[model samples]
Structures are given as C-alpha cells and as structure tokens.
Target: MLLTFAILLTTAVLLVSLSRRLGLGSVLGYLVGGALIGPAGLRLVTDVHDIAEFSELGVVMLLFLIGLEVRPRRLWVLRRAVFGLGSAQVAATGVAIAAILAAGGLAWPAATVLGAGLALSSTAIVLPMLAERDLLGAPAGRTAFAVLLFQDLAFVPLVAAVPLLAMGPSSHGLPTEVPWREVGLGCAVIAAILLGGRFLVRPVFRAIGGARTPEVFTALALLVVIGTATLASLAGLSTSLGAFLAGVLLSDSEYRHEIKSTIEPFEGLLLGLFFLSVGMAANLGLAVAEPGFFALALLGMIATKTLVAFLLARLAGQPDASALRVALSLCQGSEFSFVLFAAAVGVGALDQEAADRATLVIALSMAATPLLFAASERLVIPRLGRERPRVFDRIEDDGAPVIICGFGRVGQIVGRVLRMRGIAFTALEKDPAQLDVVRRFGEGVYYGDPTRHDLLRAAGAERARVLVVALDDMEEVLQVVDIARRNFPNLKLVVRARNRRHAYLLMDRGVGDLVRDTFHSSLRLSELVLRDLGIPEAEAGRAVALFRDYDERRLVESHAFYTDEKQLIQSNAQAAEELTELFAADQRRLESEAAARSRVGAGD
Candidate 1:
C-alpha cells in the first residue's frame, strides 16, 4: 500500500505539473495518472477498494471545508436559489434523464436511480474549477453552489429511497421488504446527529482552543469531522453529509478559519487521490468492447444534463451567459454516483452490467468537465453575453458634475448621498440588474464597464468635476483609478479601497481621497461598543477620532514599505506601539482633567 501510494504521488506531481504547463487542470492530470497506474494500464495497484476507502476521506474533508465557508446567513439570503432553483433543477433533470433511460428499455426503478444520480453534478470537481478561475463569487458560481448545496442535502433521502425502490427486486438475491422501522430509526439518528453536532461540537472545540496549541486544535478539528461522519454512517446516512453539517455548525465560529487552513492541505491531497482512484477504476476492457455505445452514452448524458441545467437556470431568471456557464459547469456526473450505483447493485435494484456502463459514463463525464468549462470560456461567454456597444453609446452627457464607476453597495450609498446633496452624477454599472434597479429608482445608472476609456469619456468623465471610483473589485477599482488618472487628470478622484493593501496600491498609483471601505464602519462600531461599556459618548467619540487619525497617519507612513514584507511588518509594529502610547497619554490627560474639575467643585 505504501509503495503504491509513493508511485501514485510521484506520478500525480509529474502529470499535474505537466498539465499546468499545458493549461489543463490538475483533475485531468490526476485522472490520467490514475489510469496509467491502475488495473486498466500497468496494473501497479490492483486492490482499488483499499485506495477508494482512503480516498473517500478526501471527499469528507472537502465537504467540511465547503461547510466552513458557507455561513447560515448567506444560505438564508440565497434561499430562493438554493431551495427554488436548486430543487427544480434536481427534479427536472432527474425526471428527464430517467425518462430517457426508461425509453432505452431499462427498469423504471433502476432508471430513476441512475437518472437522479447523473443529475447531480460533480461538486468536488466543479467548485475547485470555478474557484481556480476566480468565479466562485460571481453570479454563476453562487448559483452553482446553491444548486450543489441542495444536492448534498438531497443525497440522504435519495440513498434512503434506493432501498425502498429495490423492495421488489429481480436478479440479485437481496431483501424484498422495505424496512420502515429501520428507515424511521435512521431519520431519528440523523436528527440526533444534527442536534448533537450543533450543541456538542462547538463546546468541545472551544475547550480545546483554550489550550492554544495549534496541533491540538488541528487534532480536535479532525476528530469532530471523523466523529460526526462515523455517527452519520452508523445512523445510515452518508458520511459526507455529517461532515458538511459539522462544517455549517462551525461556519460562524471564531475557529472556522483556523480549522479551514489546517484541514485544507489534507482535503486537497485526499481529493486528488480520490480523483486518481476514479481514473484507476476505469474499465478499459468494457470501453474497448463497445466503443460506439460508450461514446454515444457519454455524449448523451452530457447533452441531457447540460440542457436540463441550462433550461432550469434560464427559468430561474439567470442571463444567457450565466445560464450557459452554469449548464456547462454542472453537466457531469458526481462522485456520489459511484456510491449510489454500488449500493443499488448491492440491493439487486441494478445489475452488474448496467452499473459498469453507468460508471464508465460518469467517469468520462467527470473527465469532460474541464473541457466543458473551457468550451464555455472560449466559445460561450464572449459570444453570448451583453453585447458591448460603441462604449456607452446610450449615455448622454447631461453635464453631470460627478461620474460614479460602480452601482453596487458602496456606489449606491455614494449615489444616495450625492443625490441628497442635490449633486448630479452619472453612474456606470456593468450589471444590467443593478442598472435596472437604480433606473427604476430614477437614478441614471448606465450599463457599461467604466474601465473602458471611451465609456468613461461618454459618462462625462472629461467634463465631470469629480470621479468617484466606488467599485467593489480591487482590480476594477485600480483599473478605473488608472484610467481616470491618465485621461481625466483634472477630475478629483474619490476611490473606495477594498483594504489597506488596496489603499497602498492606489496611493502608489497617485490617487488621492481614498476611503477604506470598512474602516469607518469598524471605527463607528468600536465607538458604539465603548459607549455601551459606560464610557461617556463624547469621550468615546474622541477616542474613535484619535484612533482613526492615528491609523490614517500609519497608513501614509507605511505606504513606502508596502513592497517589502519585512519592512512592512517592522513599520506596522512600530506604528502600533506609538498609537498605544499616544492613546494611553490621552487617557491620562482626560482623567487628570476630570480630577481637576471634581476638585474645583468640592472647594466651591
């Protein structure tokens, strides 16, 4: 086993590096590596079951990390997408695929199982791909995540339904009666796991955290993941489901980030291993025997799922480009298909021949996922998105005094303030939905990317008195700042900085009047907390003002060292010490003044 692992790791590193150079994803490399080393090729590792069991750990950790990132509040905000669009996509795709399979002369029960299984896309594959391309925060990525979240949640019931579906089985010797009592008990166990994880896991981690040892915290995190998975398995639920629940429970915890960082390496390595195992398990013999049939099935499944996904996304009101991207991304069969099919075969619901064929299609689809994303990028996105008109041809220069680049949260607030002050501004928003919303509110938000020089000019950037760069993305913010600096040099620029780093970069690029997006809000929150803790309102306000002034000064002082990590660290430490001393001196002076006033009142 150790020798096999050593060979696998070595092959994965080599192939993955080569794949990177070739611009193919690591998933493809892992798959190829697995195929080269598996029974289908050199047969270096024949006992796939052992490797599979070990690789399954990767999926568990992956789901756990995903859970940690997904806050309950965010989920609630995306409830419509998650429950509505997600549920609809799953049902529609499942039924569509099942009907197709039944038309091909498969049993309804088996077809239904396979159809639902194939409807679920490879979350493990799709998410990493989306994140790699920096689209996880985009509309398409969020929509995909919502749908995948629903699928993970739906897996439990789907597994349960398999046994019930197999009650009147044919070929394989299995139980013929549905176990209602066991099913009820399983549901009860799942509830118990959820309740216990919610109430139990946090306190356990909290207790371990007080130790302040990094290794201890890491151990405790793994323990929570493994323990929850074990409990779920015992309760007849998917282990990945338990891990996911545990993650969601810890999402809002202080230790969530730490836990994620610690477990990420393990998750990544294990996931790659799992993918490699998938490649190794490919039945080359079956493929060689029926090449045409296999090809047709693979293409058919991809087309079916992609069509279903695209239609569902469109029905849910996503734009053509986003819907197309979502469709292409999710058109593959998931890792869960293997589990479902294996279970189906164990229960005589599906035959061995059908299972092997389905598995082959799924594996091929998984391999095709990266290619699908590439196709979306190269072919779909550019051709289908909102056509770029001769930059801002729709905008009329109304002699607007100000030009706002973005119409998102920060931009909207800035627009509101400017409007309240009777200042005229032309807002350039890239998102059509945002443009429509602001237009409905009687604001002139144009639909165009402001980074384009012609669009900026059309938005009256040349005539505008001030150019407010209130875009959310730091890259866009920097781009707009550069364009304004070069083209509209006279326009006083008020740029929003995503963070201190962004502010430093903007400063380096010669932009003045920058607002750190959350800096003021954080100061205000701190002031409120100070006031709540019995400090006088005036005193609290003064402290906040002093702190803000000191921080701003520090920012300016440290701007020169931003390029050098070591210098930046030293400068930050020095600035922090100086601020602490300054605050302490101010506190002493305030106390002294209070004492003097009290003394004067006593004498009187």
Candidate 2:
C-alpha cells in the first residue's frame, strides 16, 4: 500500500510540475500521470477501484473549502444567476444534447440520462482554474460559478433517477417513475443538515475551540464533514452536497479561516488523486481503435455545450465577451458524468460498450478544457475586440500634479485634503454608481480602473508627480504599483495597505510609502483610551509616537522573514516582547526624571 502511494505521489509531482511548465494545468498533468501508471501504459497499479474510492475524499474536501469561502449574503446576491440562468442553461443544454443523442439512434430514456450528464460542466475542474487565474470576481467567472452551483444541486435527483430509469417499463414491484418519497426524504435531509449546521455545528465547534487545541479542532472539523456527508448519503443525496452544506453553515463562523487552513493541504492532495483516478479510467485503447469517431464525438460535445452555454449566458443579460468566456470555460463534460455513466452501466440502463465510449468522451473533454479556456483568453476574446473605454477616458487631462487611483472612502478623503490645499489632482474610479454620485456634486472623479495602463496613461499618469493608490483590492493595488513603477518611474506612490500582511507585501515589492488603512485611526483611539485612563494627552501622544516608531522599525526588520511562516511567527512574538519591555523601560525612565525634578524643586 505504501509503495503504491509513493509511486502515485512521485508521478503526480513530476507530471504536474511538467504540465505547469508547459502552460497546461496541473489537472491535465495528473490525468496524464494516471494514464501513464495505470493499466493503460506502464501498468504500475492494477486495481484502480480502491484508489478511486479514496480519491473521492478530495472532491468532498474541495466542496467543503468552497463552501467556507462562499458567504450566504454573496449567494443571496447571486440568486438570480444561480436559479434562473443556471436552470435555463442546464435544461437547454441537456435537452439539446439529448435530442442529438436520440437522433443518433440511442433510446430516449438512455439518451436523456446521457444528455443530463453531458449538460453538466466540471465544477471541480472549472472553479479551481478560474480561481487560480484570479478571474472568479469577473463577470464570466461569476456566471460560471452560478451555473456550477445549480449543477451540484441537480446532481442529487439525477443520481436518484438512475435506478428508476434502469428498472424499465415492465419491471415487477418497481415502478418506472420518479420516486417522490425518496426525493422528499432527500429534501428533508438537506433541510436538516442546514438547520443542524446553523444551530448545532457552530456551538460544537465553539465548545471544541474553547479547549484551544489545534488537533482536537481539526478532528472535529473532519468529523463534521464526514458525519454530514454520511448522513447525506444515507438520505439519498450526493456526499459533496452534504459537505458543501456543512461548509456554507460554517462560512460565517469564527473558526472558518482555521477550518479552511486545516483542510486545504489534504484537499489538494486528494483532488490530485481524484484527477489521477480519472486518468487511469481513460480507455486510450478504444480511442486508438476509432480515432476519427472519438475525435468527432469529443469536438461535437464541446461545440454543442459551448453553443448552449453561450446562448443561455447571453439570454441572461451577460455581455457578449463575458458570455463567450463562460461558454468556453464550461464547454467540457463534468467529473460527475463518470459516476453517472458507471452507475448507469451497473444498473443495466446503459450498455457496457456505450458506457466506455461515453467515459472516454468525458475524460477527453475534461483534458481539453484548460486548453480551450487558454484559447478563448488569448485568441477568441482578443478578436472580439477590446473592451470599450470608460467615461473617464473621454475627459480631458489637465496634467494634474497628483492622480488618485480609487475614489472610495480613502480616496475621497485624500482628494478632499488635496482640494483644501489647492493642489490639482485627478481622481479615477472604477465603479459607475459611485462615480455617478460623486460627479453630480461636481467632483473630478472619473470612471476608470487605474490598474489599466491605458487608463492610467489617459489620466496623465506620465505627467503626475504622485500616484495615490486607495483601491480596496490588494491585487489591483499591486498591479497598479507594478505598472506605475515600470512606466512612470518618477511618480511617487502613496498606497493604502489593508493590513500588516498587505503592507509587508507592498514594501517587499518596492513600495516606499504606504499607510495601513486604519492603523493611524486605531492609534488615535488607543490614545483616547489612555487619556480617559488619567494619562495626560501629551504623555499619551508621546507614547503613541514611540510605539509607532518601534512598530515601523520592526516591520522593516521582519519583512525578510514574512514569507517564512515559522520564522515570521517567531519574529513577531519576539518583537512584541521587545516592544513591551522597551515601553516599560521608557516609562520608568520618565518617572525617575520627574521624581528627580520634584526633589530638586523641594530642596530649592
């Protein structure tokens, strides 16, 4: 068992690394590694069933982590996309694919099953890729996520229907119809899980967490996941759904961050194994025997799914480019299709030969997805034409002395201060609504993302003496900083940092001056606290100044170790102790000086 595990890990690392270097995703690499080591190629491992079963944990964990990141409010905001657009995409794509299969001489019942499977895109594959490329916040990515959510919800009933479909029309004691009783049970189970998670899971975690033991907390987290999944399976629902619900329940919990960090490593490894199993299942021999047919099938599926997705996205009011991106990203078959097809074969709903062919098509489609996305990003979207310039671009540049990137709370204050000083500055903002509100009041806020080089240049970044970055997103801040440093080397940067970590990152990337967004206000609050505690205002201010100086110095000194977790933690602890001692010594010295002055005055 150890040997098999070792071989799998070694193969996964080497191939995944090579794939990454080749610009294909790690998923493709894992698939290739699986194929190379499985019965198809070198035959390193004979029994794939065991590996597949174990690898499913990866999918469960992936869903769990995704749930952790997804806030209920965000889901509510995306309700229209998740339900309306998602439902339409699934129904349309499934019906279209089913019609095609039926026309190709397959029975309607089997064809419907196949169509539903094919209509579903690989959420496991697509979501991670979108996240890796930092596109999840983009319109196309959000649309893809919405569709994936609905697909996951649909997986429960679809799996349930397989047995009924397999029973055929004349089976005794088995009605060939939708099982309403089972469906009701599944819904009840889902509701119970949600209610339990809301009322039960949080309190349990809180109790466990009060123990302050990491291992215990981790164990509880795993228990909750597995336990919920087990219950979900017993209730005739997908285990992934249960895990997802568990995650959503704890999404707003205080322990959410810790839970995510705990499970992330396990999730990555398991997900890799899952992909590897998928590769092992691929029937390359069949593909070789009917290359033309296999190629045509794969292409046709991709094209059909992409067309359906694109039309649905467009109908849902997405922009053409965004719709195209959504289509291209999700034009592949889902991992669930493998499970569904396998189950269908087991239940006699599908023939073995047909099942094998369908499995191969799904695998090939999954492999081609990353490449398809790349093509859309590099080739298709570019040809579609550049995005239209923002309203800010049409405005004339006055060659202002300063250019502020964002016009949120921080930017507004900065702009206000500059205006009060009679300093000419150009304020650029990305949000149309915010710009509209500010523009009505005759503020010079323009609608444009300053991270865009063209937009920055248009805003006279070249002529500006200073560029103020007040954007809330650290990624955008870093991008604008990089561009400004490269293109406008002479422009001084005054950035707003979200926190210590953000500040460290900015400083590491050569940002000279940055203000921790709320650090000064926090210090002011602390000063007021000291004043209220009977400390003189001047003394409180002096102490704050001293602490700030030491803190800044410590930040600079600790920047080198920031990337090393252990070293960073140790350094921070040591710095905190030193700061405490230093303040204590300073307080003692001040007290001594006051005492000496009082004694001298009394003697006089």
Candidate 3:
C-alpha cells in the first residue's frame, strides 16, 4: 500500500511539472499520466476503479470553489449572452445533432438526449484556461463563459430528464411514469440542504474554526461536503448536482477560502486518479477493432459542432471575430457528455453498445482538446482577424508630456483637471477587461502594462515631464516608481498612497511627490471651513500649503523607521501627529512675530 501511494505521488508531481514546462495545461498531463499508468500501458494503477472513486474528491472541491464565485450580480451582468447566446448555442446544436441522429435511425428521445449531451462543453476545462491566459471577461471570453455557464446550469435538467424521458407512453401518469414524488422529494431535499448551509453548516464551521486547528477545520469542512453529497445521492439526484449545491451553500461562509485551500490538494490528487481510471477503462481492444468508426465520430463531432457554434453565435448578434472564438471554444464534446450518457444508459435510455459508443466519442474528443485549443491561436485567430473589430480603437499617446498609470476614481479626477486645461497626456492600464469597458466609455486610454519598460517608452516615458503612479497594486506601484526613477529620472513622479504606511514606503523608494490618503481631501477642506469661517482666504491657503509640506517631510522621515513593526506604526501615526502639532505651533509663532514686525514698521 505504501509503495502504491508513493508511485502515484511521484508520477503525479513529475507529470504535472513536465506538462507546465512544455506550456501544456496540467489537466492534459493528468489525463496523459493516467493513460501511461493504467492497464492499457504499464498497468501500474492496478486498482483503477478504487483510485478513480477517491479522485472524485477533485471534482467535488472544484465545483465547490466554482460555486463560491457564482455571484448573482455577475450572472445578471451577462444576462444577454447567458440567455441569448448560450441558449441559442445549446438549442441549435441539440436540434442539428438530433436531426442527424434521427436520420441515422435512432429514436427521437434518444437522439434528442444525445444531441443535448454532446452540445455541452466543459466549463471546468475551458473557463480556467481562458482566465489563466487573462482572457476571461474579454469580448470573446465573456461569450465563452456565458455559453459554459448555460451548460453547467443545464446539467440539473439533463440529469432529471434522462429518467423522465425514458418513461414510455403507457405509463404517462405524472406520479407513476414521471416520478413526481421522487422529483418533489428531491427538490425538498435540495431546499433543506440550502437552508442548512445558511443556518446550520456556517455556524458549525465557525465554532470549529474558533479552535484554530487547521486540521479540525479541514476535516469538518470535508465532512459537510461528503455528508451533503451523500444525502443528495440518496434523494435520487446526481452526486455531481449535490456536489455543486454543496459548493453554493458554503459560498457565503467567511471560511470559504479555508475550505477551498483545504480541499485543493485532495481534489488535485483525486482528479489525477480519475483521469488514470479513464485510461484503464479505455478498452484498447475495442478501439483497435473500430478505429475507423472512432476517427469518423471524432471528425463529425468537432466539425458539425464547430459549424453549429459559429452559426448560432452569429445569429445571436456576436461579431464575426467573437463568433469564431466561441465556435472553436465549444467545438469539442465535453466530459459531462460521458456522465450524462452514462445516466441515460443506466436509466435505459440507451443499450450497452450505445453507451460504449458514446463513451468512445467523448474520450476521443477529450484527447483532441489540447491540440485544438493550442492550434487555435494560429489556425483559428488569423482567419477570424481578417475582419475588422466592431469596437472603436483606443487613442494613441501622440507624444504627450504626462502619462497616468491608472484611471480609477483618483486618477480620473486628476486626468479631468489636466484635460480641462488642454494638457497633452496619455493613460496606461493593465486590465484587458477594464480597458474594453473604458474604451467604450470614451476615456481613450492606452492598453498596456505600465511596469514593462517598452510600454513605458511607447507612452513617451523618456521625454515625458511628469508621470503619475495611481495604480492599485502596491507591489506593481513600487516597481513602476523604481523603474521610472531609473529610466526617466528627469521626469517628476506623483503617486497615490493607500495610507501613511504606503506613503513612507513610496517616499523611501525615492518618490518625492505623493498624495497620501488623498481621498480624504474633501473632508479636510470641510474641516477648514468649519474651524474659521471669518479667517482670511490667504491664511487658509497658507494653512493648507503647510499641511501638505509637513506631510511630505513626515513621509520622508518615516522611511527609515519601517523595518521595526512597532516603530513603523509609531512613525506613521504618532510621529505624523506630533509633527503636525509642532508645525501648527511654529506657524502661530511665526505669524505673531510678523504681526509685531508690521506694528513696528507702522510706528516708524
């Protein structure tokens, strides 16, 4: 047993590392690793079935993490694409494939189920890959996410439908043939689980978490997931469905991150095992006997579905380029198709031969996914890019004297003030999604990472007289300051600090100009008005000027004090306060001496 565990662990680490080094996704590595170890090859994974069962924990945790991120507002944000583009893709593909199968002499019920099953794409596979490449929420990426989301939601009904559709015409009564009682009981059970997650599970986890032993928290969280999944299976719903709901239930918990982190290692190990079990179960003898059939099925599945995805995306109002992206993304049949097909066969929707064929088609497509997605950049994108984009192109730098790193609230106000005076300035941002939206809003911001020296040069960083680092990422902000101080040392730099702490850090890094907690400027202005309504305008101006200068000096002083945590806080808060008090006192003393000087001059 010890040897067996050691082998799996070593193989998993090796396969994953090698895959990443080759720029292939770890998912592909897991699948390939499984095939290499399973019966079809070395047969090292002798207990494939048992290992596969344990590996299912990966799927459970993955779904749980996915559920936590499923915010309603995000769904609402994608409303048009979710219902329109997504619904169109599934319905169109289902109908087209159903027609083809019906012509091939399958029953309407069977064909329809197969069509829907085949139409669904793997959200698990595609979504993360897109996100990792920083493509999620892009025009094309959002459309892909919308379609994937639709597929995940459709799983609920797909699972429910297999049993209900298999009921023949003679047993058409809702209770007997359709199993309404079971359906209702399932719904009630799911409802109870939802309520229990909110009222019972959250509080229970919180109490356990108070002990602060990560082991106890991890064990208890796993228990809740397994217990809920078991309850769901007993209620006659699919275990996957229960697993998804279990994730959704825990989404609101503060311990959501803890739950996810605890389960990730378990899930990764198990998912690897699951893929290996798939390899062991491949039935090479059958594949050899019908290699031609497998080839034909693979081609037909990808080609027909790609065309269907393309046509549906166009009909749903997507531009040609974005439509092409969707077409490629969903062209391959998903892993869930195997799960759905299995459910259909288990409930007598298809016979043994049919189940084997369905399984073969899914495996073949899954194998092809990596090649297809990789080839997409060269093969798919160029063909799609011939056509122009629908959106407007952003404005270029045009050799501006000033460039701002971020376009958030503070950045925007500064930008508007500069623009009002007709100052020549450029803006830079790293977020593709934000750039997509910001361009539409007519900000005309340049899309690039400011940290890259090349991008800085393109924005006229060398010739520019001033640069503002208003970006949110603190580490990135420091890097920008450091880079600017090196390359464009002549250019003046102004940065926004989140607090006095960040102010000191920025000052230490040699950024002379900074606005620390600048968001409070309005409140400070209001305080001045309340304190001395009858005070001269010049006096108020001098007071504001002194405060600003004192802040800059304090920030400079606090720089050397940060290495010690206790001194860090004292320098930032206590030191700043004491300095401010001394500054005010000195100002009053200077003003009194000036008044005396004026009186003496009048007497003379």
Candidate 4:
C-alpha cells in the first residue's frame, strides 16, 4: 500500500511541476499523472473506487474552508444568487438535458436522474479553476460559487429521490417508498450539527486552545470536519453540506484562521488525490471503441450546460463577458454525479453500461475544463471586452519626493508635515477602513498593499527620494524594506519600529533610519517627570539627554547579542550600572563646583 502511494505521490510531483512550468495548472497534472499510472494506462493501482471514496474528503474540506470565508452575513447577502439564479440554472439545464435524453429513448426516470446530476456542475473543479485565475472574488466567480452551493444543498434530495425512481430494484434492495425515518434522522442530525457549531463547538475549541498545543488543536479541527461529515453520511445527507455548515458556524470564531491554515494542506493533498482517482477511473477503452459516440456525448453535454448557464446568468442581470465566463467556468459535470450514478445503477434506475459511459464523459469533461477556460480567457473573453475586476487601486504619481507606505497616524502626520513644507509626496495604505477615514479628511492616499512590488513602482518608489515604512504590521514593514532593497536598491527606507525587538530586526535588515514609535515620547515623559519633582530645568534636560545617548548606544550594542538571552541580560545589567555611575559622578562634580564658588565668595 505504501509502495503504491509512493508511486502516486512521485508521479504527481513530477507531472504537477512540469504542468506548472508549462503554465498549465496543477489539476491537469494530477489528472494526467493519474491517467498514466491508472488501470487503463500502466495499471499501477487497480482499485480506484477506494481511492475515490477517501479522496472525496478533499471536496468536503474545500467546502468547509470556503464556508469559513463566507460568513453568515455574506451568505445572506448572496441569498438571491444562491436561490434565484442557482435554481434557475439547475432547473433549466436539467429539463433541457432530460428532454434530450428521453427523446433518445432512455427511460424518463433514468434520464431525469442523469440530467439533474449532470446539470450540477463540478464545484471541485470550478472553484479551483476560478482561484487559479485569481477570480474567486469576481462577479462570475461569486455567481459560480453560489450555484455550486445550491447544488450542494440539492444533492441530498436528488440522491434520496434516486431510490424512489427505481420502480423495481433487484440488486441492493433499495426501498421504493420515501424513508421518513431516515429523512427525519437526517434533519435531526443537521440541526444537531448546527446547534453544536453555535453553542458547543466554540467552547470545546477554546478548551483545547487553552492547552496551547497546536497539534492537538489541528487534530480537533480535523475531528470537527470528519465527525460532522460522518454524522451526515450516517444520516443519509451530503457530507460536504455538513462540513460546510460547521465551517459557516465557526467563520465568526477567533480560531477560524488557525483552523483554515491547519486544514488547508490536508485538503490540498486529498484534493489532488481525488483528481487522480477520477483520472484512474476513466475508462479510456470505451471512448476509444466508440469514438464518434464519445465525442458527440462530451461536446453535447458541455455545449448544452454552457448555453443554459449563460442564458440564466444574463437573465439574472450579469454582463455579457461575466455571463460567458460563468457559463464556461462551470460547463463540466460534477464529482457528486459519480455517487448519484452509482446509486442509480445499484437501485436499477440506470444500467452498468450506461453508468460506465457517463462516468467516462464526466471524467473527460473535468479534465477538459481548465483548457476550455484558458482558451476562453485568451481568445473569447478579450473579444467580448473585459470588465476589470476590483483590485489594488491605481496609483497616480507626479514625481513625489517621498512615498509613504502606510497612511495611519504616523503616516498621516508625515504627509501633513510634507504638505506644510510644500513638498510633493505620495502615500499608499492597504487598510480599507483607514483609507476611508483618511479620505473623509481629504487626504490623497492610494489604496494598496505597499509590500507589492508593482504597487511600489506605481507609487514612484524609484523616483521618490525616500520610502517610509510606517505600516502597523511589523511583517509588512520588513517586506517593504526587503522589496525596496531588492528591487529599488537606491531607495532609502525610513521605517518605524513598534518595539525594541522590532528596532533590532530593522537594524539587522540594514535599515539605517529606524525610529522606535514610543521611544522619544517615553523620553519626553521622563524629562517632564523630573521637572515635576523639583529638578532644575537644565539638570532635567541634561539627565534626559544623557539617558537618551546611553540608551541609543546600548540599543546598538544589544543588537549584537539580542538572539542570545544570557548575553543580552548581561549587557542590559552592565549598561544600567554604568548609567548610575555617570549620573552620580555628574552630581558630585556639580557639588564640588558649587563648594568652590561658595569658598571664593566667603574669601571676598
């Protein structure tokens, strides 16, 4: 088993790397790798069904992660798309396909099941396809996701109805009657998961989080998804649906990001395996034996679904290019259809021969989807005209002498001072909330992440005399520094450090003009306190200046041993002793000078 897995992984790595290098996506590579080592190819692993079942978990995890992003408010906002457009597309496509199949002399029940199954596009394929193109937040991508969400909701009922469609079942003995008990149990389980997600899940996560063991937290995250999925499966519901619900519930939780990060690798690996399994399960001989039939079926399915989806999207008020994109993105058959088809055959609603043929068509369509989208993107989308998606704001530069990366409090002050001096400067801020606030005050700051090289160049980093890294995020400051150093080698970096450690890190990174945000203010407060305690003004100023000089020197010295705790502590203690002695000596010198002046006055 291990040897077989080793072969699968090795094949995936090589093929995926080649595909990525060739500008084709990872999905294609996994599919081709699977085909190469599959039963129809080299026959490295024959039992594709087991692998398919296991890898289906990838789909569940994908949905869960997606759910984490789509919070309840966002989902509510998408209610129209999810219900109206999604339902219209599914119904219109299903009816059209079913009518065609019935006209071709297939039984109405089987045709209906096939059409419904096929009408539901592949969420597994479409989501990743859109993601690769960086379109997940675009109108077409959002619409596609909404439709897929509806399909997930529709899948359970579709599967449930399959048994009812089989009038006389000889194999596997599925009941013709609607199983009320099972249906009730499924609803009950869904409610339990929902309730648990609301009231129980967070508390459990909190307890586990309190333990401060990351592995255990990761394990619990997996357990939540798997456990919910298992319960849904036992209750005869869609496992992805259960996991999606769990994710949505936890979306607003503090732990969502951690859970997402933890589950993502497993999801990615298993998803690759799922694609591989699909490739392996493809019966290439059937396509080879009946070339004409195979080509006609494949073309017909994609064309019909694409047309129906495009029309529906248009009716839903989507623009021409976005509608076309939505259509092309989801023209393939779903992975869930495999389960539906298998159940249909088991219940005698569909023949094994028909199922095998449909399976091949679906697999091929999944493989072809990426190519189809790529072609449309390159050839068709440009012709239809492009509706530019919202991204980082375009920066307008007029040879600003200074480019401020962050437009928060520190950045705003810098901009204000520059404006007062009549110095031309450009400011960039990534935080939308901060940008909105700045705009209200009539500040001219372009919205963008300063860490991006493109945005930096657009903001006139090369022309600007100085690049200020005043971002609230310490990591972003470092990133800006690095980008400046690597890309614009001559650009000077004036960075603000949040603390001593941040200052030390900046020093290590070769940022010469570094200011600790609170250091000067703290020193001023200390000077004020000395004055309040009846110390002379000159003495107070001298004391503050003395401490400032000492600390600055100490900070630089400590940078060398910052990583070594013992050395840092020793240096800190030694600096404190030296500062005390210097203050004591200064006070004695003042007393001696006063005494000499008093004796001279007495002699006079």
Return the top candidate by lDDT. Answer: 4
**42-80 in candidate 3: lDDT tens per residue?**
878788767767766666666666666554555677888
> How do the candidates rank by TM-score, highest first?
4, 2, 1, 3
For model 1 the local lDDT of residue 262 reads: 82
* lDDT for each residue of candidate 4 in 1-604, tens digit (9 for 90 to 100): 7988998899889998997676667888888889999999999988888998999999999989988877788889899999889888889999999999999999998899889888988888888878887687688999999999888889988888887887756477865467789789988999999999999999999899778888999999999999999999999788998999999999866566668878999999999999999889899999889999999999999999999999999998889999999999889999889889988999899999988888899988998888888888878888887844446788887898899989999999999999999998899998777898999989988988787888999888888899988999775676678678767988888999999998987887788899999999999999999999999999999999988998998888889889799988888889889999999998899889989999999999
Per-model lDDT? 0.85, 0.86, 0.74, 0.88
Q: Lowest-scoring 10 consecutive residues by lDDT in candidate 4?
A: 168-177
Question: What TM-score does model 4 achieve against the real structure?
Answer: 0.69
Q: How does candidate 2 score on lDDT?
A: 0.86
In terms of TM-score, which candidate is strongest? 4
State the local distance difference test value for candidate 1. 0.85
Error of 4 at 379 (Å): 1.0
Descending-lDDT candidate ranking: 4, 2, 1, 3
- Count of residue pairs whose backbone atoms collide, per candidate: 0, 0, 3, 0
Alpha-carbon runs more than 4 Å astray in model 4: 168-176, 387-604
Model 1 per-residue lDDT at 397: 92
